[model samples]
Target: MRGVTRSAQGRGELTPMESRILRAAVRLFAEKGFDATTVQEIVDAAEVTKGALYHYFDAKDDLLFEIYHSLISSQMADLDRIIALRLSAADTVRAILVNLVETTASRVDEAAVFTREMHKLNADRMAAFRADRRRYHETFREVIDRAQTAGELGTVVPADTAVLIALGVVNQLPTWYRPDGPKSPQQLGTEIADFVLAALSA
Candidate 1:
């Protein structure tokens, strides 16, 4: 499947100040909730002026959208790359899961904040987010569907159901996953992939 275009398409790389402001916003949004976070608080946390913050992001809503947008954009790129490799269906699925887990784990704060506060985004941004996610979901389901049709995977569960089961765990990572946890993200991802592939084989 083609990579979904980023919401911030045509935006160049973020300057250092922009990165600082985004990091501060993610931290504050995760800690204090989006509505409670003020622009002044983000500036204070980022150690930048209010003007600096506005220079990169128009409002708090922009920060929220950017946080998740960057993540999903990266994931979509990885998905396209994996699909282009022409790997076996199981290998492709494994690579996608591993990449998703590691990336999400690396930016746990961003994921957590976005998951908790994404409802605050403007309608346009929200629609963009949903469309990106739907593309990812449909692409993944197509992979499984083709594999099943070719008899490479069993039909123990429908492709859509399988996608939901796989993604459900990743979506819940923020609530319980810890950076200092016993299992590394890659390890957790492998185990999850093992379970998923096993189910498909059954």
Candidate 2:
């Protein structure tokens, strides 16, 4: 397999072919369910050749992994950038929630497919996913923990519990979120941040 490549694929920063293939696969996986989607279907939808598809991915599982990996990697990058800014605890938490919601909401199809199909992932992919999630969770918790310890934030709840609650809302959002809903992801994220910050202060 050539593996996933990142070229000048418009604003998504993926290769044009890679972007089309991934989008096609995610749409098919979401609509037909992963078990029912096939490599041929993806290739046809993407308008790419079998050799082109094989050049980027070794198998169907690789496509599934990449579909999920793309979002997580982007979120992780945003988190790193936010942390580097060294903002206050509240500011940092707000940034994280907002970024996460926007990212997760934008490509909700990918998220939905992963949620329902991730159990089929191989052991290595499973471990990698778990590790990335754990790191993101722990890193957020630590930010809250440090702030509380330093007297910059209130200890209204344990940082672990707090982080869990904050992330829980975003993770389960795909089931209910609508692009045509009352609020955009940005607005919803702010409201969420407000509620969390208020709870912390109280």
Candidate 3:
């Protein structure tokens, strides 16, 4: 399989063909189980030839892995960049929530693709993917840990628990979040951050 190539950093842009194929893969995989979604379906949905699909991916599993990686990797890169900026831990936590919720909501199809199909990767591939996911979580945990050490957060709360709460709030937003809802993503993020901050300070 061709190694995944990026057109730019922090931009979730894909080659035109890659985009089409990915869109088809996500849609089909979401509606049909990975095992049930065939290369012909993807090629037809993508409006590409069988040879075109083969040029980009070796097989259905390869396409799935690339699609999942592309979705999560872009998110991780965006969050990592934001976290690296020296914003206050409180602000950083809020930023993390907003970013996560907004991304999850905006990329609903991709998130659905991930939640529905990630288990289809072979064990070795899944393990590597899982590690990347853990690193992203660890990124948030480290920031929360720093905040706790600096007395910005409650000393009583375990860092891992604090991180989990923050992430849990953000991660679950896609389940119920509506773009036209009363609360903006930013507002919801602030609310969640406020709850975390208050609880941690107590």
Candidate 4:
């Protein structure tokens, strides 16, 4: 099993050393493929010693796991809390999309690295990642499924299909979403939500 950081972006979740190592890793990982980025390079980039890097992460792969885990864990926490509010389906979906966009946009480097290197995670880490992803997918599916079952939304497609379509676009944003672009993540999320709700409402 790889080392796991509780929350990469959460204030106080990581020590200053942990944060520095993580930032350096994201930069290096984004610039060079994970296979090409060495631990010594990470230490030099972060200006930390080998001991500091090893203290926080078990190995380079552990660093990779941490980079991807932290982002999803953060998103899942937001999703869980928003869903607990028991908002109407449209509102819940809006909260989720907006949060997802904002979070993903803020962590583009992590997302990009994960997209390219995630298949390398160990079996245990892979299982954990899969569980986190499934929870997120199922939660969103339930929202749509419940709405359709209650006759609140049009049944244009299965809940799984709708979820995949919605997540697919956001997941691909790493290739082209520019933080300096005209729209802020919030605005983009709202626009996306509007489009998705339009489909459900029709």
lDDT of each residue in 1-202, candidate 1, tens digit only: 0112335462324567767888988889878899999999999999998887877777787888888877877788888899999999999989989998998999898999899888988887788789778988998899999999999998999999999999999989989999999999999999999999999999
The runs of at least 3 residues in candidate 3 whose Cα sits more than 4 Å from the true structure, single-residue gaps closed, are 1-13
lDDT of 4 at 122: 80
Candidate 1 segments whose C-alpha is farther than 4 A from its true place: 1-15
Lowest summed-lDDT stretch of 10 residues in model 4?
4-13
Clashing pairs in 1: none
Question: Weakest 10 consecutive residues, lDDT, candidate 2?
Answer: 3-12
- Highest lDDT model number: 1
Against the correct fold, how does model 4 do in TM-score? 0.91
State residue 188's C-alpha deviation in candidate 1, in Å. Answer: 0.3
- Model 2 C-alpha lDDT per residue in residues 59-131, reported as the tens digit of each score: 8988887787778777877888999999988899899999999999998888888999999888866776686
Candidate 3, poorest ten consecutive residues by summed lDDT:
3-12
TM-score of each: 0.91, 0.92, 0.86, 0.91
- Ranking of all predicted structures according to lDDT, beginning with the best and ending with the worst: 1, 4, 2, 3
State model 4's lDDT: 0.85
lDDT of each: 0.85, 0.84, 0.76, 0.85
Candidate 4: clashing pairs of residues: none
